[model samples]
Target: MRTFDTDALECLAAIVEEGGFERAAVRLSVTQSAVSQRLRALEAQVGTVLLVRSRPVKPTSAGRLLIKHAMQMRLLRADLETDLQDLTPGAGALREEDRISIAINADSIATWALPALGPLVSEGLPLEIITDDQDFTHEWLREGQVLGCVTTLKQALRGCKVMPLGAMHYVAVASPAYAAENCPKGLTTHNFRQIPFIAFNRKDDLQTEFVSRACGLRRVALIQRFVPSVEGQVRAVLSGWGASVLPTLQVQSRLDSGELVNLAPDVTLPVNLYWHCWNLDSVVIDRLTAALTTAATQALKVPG
Candidate 1:
């Protein structure tokens, strides 16, 4: 097996992380040509192509392996620096941003996640947040893209610690006028099938799932509208495009104002969320976990 030098491996990892040779060069304070040469040398040493040379470059499987090692090395270096600092009297303690990266879903980020993260930000901790869909957030943890996440998955990934974040409450809602016109009686399993639905996107199935659970049916009205963002989804529902399942936090004001009516007051979907993070001993991760736990307790209702 050919031996890979530490510097070359680190360089390749930087290129992959930064997503381009030029950016990696800027990060490492080296010339673009120098970054290119190091990548070429590393690829030659490995006897395979490590990166796809395209706009916003992507890593090959071999490159991913090296990137993981590079991240581990970086963490180790950071720990060493912390140890050295500890030996000096009157040295300032390490800040949060210097220690962690987190991945979360957009709904959580927009609603409950930020409130939980306030303590960390107030303390000047360095945090990088990647917001995506709830269903797919765990993929970032699996790929080592983030050290922690708020995900819907219950199972813990290998080498990670998993804890329950809390359940998000959702209710089927429609504008008061629309509800009065279309729903003379309160919503039940039988009437839900006939109601036109507003979906966040083609990928969203919250309405469908609610209908399925409520009525034990699969077919919904073919006439559906798509609104992609959380705010847009709420607006579309409020505008009477169709009824949708919205988080209570997002639609609480409208509900209070009688602008939107709950389709079924008793019917709700509680999506249980989990926190997954690398199972490592780090003060930053611990602090984040504590903050999220406190926030979840206050914001999310316990599943019944």
Candidate 2:
């Protein structure tokens, strides 16, 4: 039987996670030279290069497999820790390497996901959250950078399980002042193109999709300003930067207070979200799934 060094494997993971050898050294409490040496030894043992040395270093395909293995081993350790704590209560604490990492969409994180995770965080679950657009979060899980993710993808990855968590309803909204000045007739076929729209990022298509659906057009385009955050987009809209498609749950207070107006009160865009996790018998995974699903059920609209 062939054996690989566990420390070396963890060094590779830390380097990739932290983005560089110096940062990885700081994370692992080792010297920078030591970090490099460990990585070299690991590559030699594996008989291939693992990482692409770039700014915010990226893993090669082989490195991804190794990273996934390392992360899975960490999950196993976390599971064992949970078992031990149940037996003795207030037992040994989890190390930094045992931190649970997951990817979630920025909108969900701003609205319901953080609150759902509060109990676990307060109880000492070392958690790392990677936020991205809902459509792209699945890539994090596919790359083995996260143990689980809340994403728009419905199909489960190989060796993964997926559960539908309903859908987030989005409404096109703008500041009352902006709406009155720019879109007095609300979002119509003629006015949508004239009114600027705030998009989360270049990757976001919700704004365009909403406009097309609302205007009964095959294709539509609007002037876009990127804000990159759910809360930031809301702030920009309130500042009269542009109109945006925002979560109804996130902007309900503003709407009620008349700070913002729904551009299409009768129309809403429903984005279906799902929870994906590895098909492993880990108590922590089960707990996370339960927490996310329960909160999503209450917070998100059931998709028709």
Candidate 3:
């Protein structure tokens, strides 16, 4: 059977998380030389260099693979410890609570996911949330940087299971005044170059994709400022900053009250999202999955 030096593997994970050997040493409460010795011993035993030893240090493919293993082990170990504590009648709580790192999209974080996860977090299960675009969260999942992720990637990884969580529907919208003033001609291929819009970030092509698919305008002019947040994006629209595609959940009330105008009232964009997590026998993971599934049912559009 292949064996591992658990401590050394953990040391490597610390380096990856803390971003440097010095910080890792501080985190592990060990001397820098001791940390170096453990890493060297680990590399020697595996006959491979697990860390790049760069300024902040990076993991090679092999290193990433090992780091993945180490992280999974940590989650399992945390579960085991929790179960053991439960069996002991008078066991005190852990000195430091265990944490499960999860990846979710920025939109989901700002919208429904956090409110759903609030109860669990309030109960003391430390949650480390990594927010990215829904389409890209799978990369974090594949790297084992997170225990699970909410993503648009529907296929399961080799060692993970995928669960469809329905979709987050989006609508093209603008403030009633902005639509009247800028889009006096309304959204059209001819006016595509003239209307202003907001982009969350460079990678955020949510506005771009909406125009092409909904209006059949592939090339567009970005004549607006970047607002890199959900509330900010909505506020920008409300303050007549620009027209942008927003999640249906965010603007539904505004649409009803005339605070926002749905430019493409009949058009909607649905991003089908899924949950991906390690295929393992873990109560903690199972509980979290159940909670997320329940939340998604309430927050997301059900598949017909």
TM-score of each: 0.80, 0.98, 0.88
Query: Which candidate's TM-score is highest?
Result: 2
Best-performing candidate as measured by lDDT: 2
| Best-first order by TM-score | 2, 3, 1
> Candidates 1 and 2: which is better by lDDT?
2
In model 3, where do residues sit more than 4 Å from their true spots? 31-33, 54-56, 85-98, 217-225
- In model 3, the Cα lDDT at residue 12 comes to 83
Summarize candidate 1's per-residue lDDT along 90-150 as a digit string, tens digits: 4555433234468887678768889888876765455678877788888877877677899
TM-score quality measure for candidate 2 = 0.98
For candidate 2, lDDT tens digit of each residue in 1-304? 5566878889999999998999999999999999999999989988999999999999999999989888898898888988898899998878877779999999999999998999988877889999999999999899998999999999998889999999998999999999899988788877887888999999999999898888788898789999998999999999999899999999999999999999999999899999999999999999999999999999988867
Q: So what's the TM-score on candidate 1?
A: 0.80
